[model samples]
Target: MLKKEQFLSYSAGAIVAGMYCGKLELNGDFFAGYEYGTGISPSLDPYFRSEMKRLEKEAEGDLKSYCSLARLMFYKGNKPKPLVAPLLIDKP
Candidate 1:
């Protein structure tokens, strides 16, 4: 019986760890290129855009709604259907 805060912390930790490994995909190219002004390949733009649009619709374009949905997904033993994980490591 984990407390609410603890559960949130653990869920976040799991997401981080998953991102650290290769099991999960990185959140977005903007994050990947934070230090540099780069992004996903132009060829992949359409695919990424469509995926984001789908997620946006799911969240009703609201940040709070998106977060709540993401948390619920985590609680329900499912990863949020969005590229929400943050980059955990940088590769050379």
Candidate 2:
């Protein structure tokens, strides 16, 4: 059986997929105007930052490094725009 956090992670991924494909309504506490890639708060979670730091070190290749930088910008906000935006798809 999946652990609680693992289940939630899968469920959240499913929700994101559904929303992106226009199968789900974008109405929720989680959906708050980060759609058009704006309004992200700059408050970085300490634990998340630490985890990212570890992952960043493990990350290989320029693309991986770029993706890490994009994720960091996503959480902390207000950095220069990434060369390619993070893979989050918006509603059509």
Candidate 3:
């Protein structure tokens, strides 16, 4: 198991790397635009929005509550009238 600080550090690095990767890919595509003999349209807004939303969702949910394969299976099998992932099923 990783120490708390180390885990946090790695997580931050991963997020930063993902964001940086997206930017790099977009930049590379921009430079390679002439391959198709047409101007490439730059659109990073949606990508950035999706990344922000993903980060927000992760921040809002607790890892403990989101994890546990056994618990997830139990809830999946015994889900009320409408079956859904345990993580998404709202508690009364």
State which candidate has the highest TM-score: 1
Residue 3 Cα positional deviation in candidate 2, in Å, after optimal superposition = 0.4
- Give each model a TM-score: 0.30, 0.25, 0.25
Q: Candidate 2 lDDT, tens digit per residue, 28-81?
A: 333343322443322233443444444444433354444444443322223464
Better of 2 and 3 by lDDT: 2
Clash number by candidate, in order: 0, 0, 0
In candidate 1, the residue pairs with backbone N, CA or C atoms under 3 Å apart (3 or more residues apart, or in different chains) clash, namely: none
Q: What is the descending TM-score order?
A: 1, 2, 3
Write the number of the candidate with greater TM-score, choosing between 1 and 3. Answer: 1
The lDDT of each candidate is 0.39, 0.35, 0.32
Candidate 1, residues 1-92, lDDT tens digits: the string is: 33333333333433343333333433344243532343224224454445444554544546555554454433222444323333332322
Q: Pick the candidate with the highest lDDT.
A: 1
Over the stretch 3-92, how does candidate 3's per-residue lDDT look in tens digits? 333333323323333333222111233124322343322123344445456644553464333223213322323445212222112223
Tell me, what's the RMSD of every candidate? 14.4, 13.7, 17.0
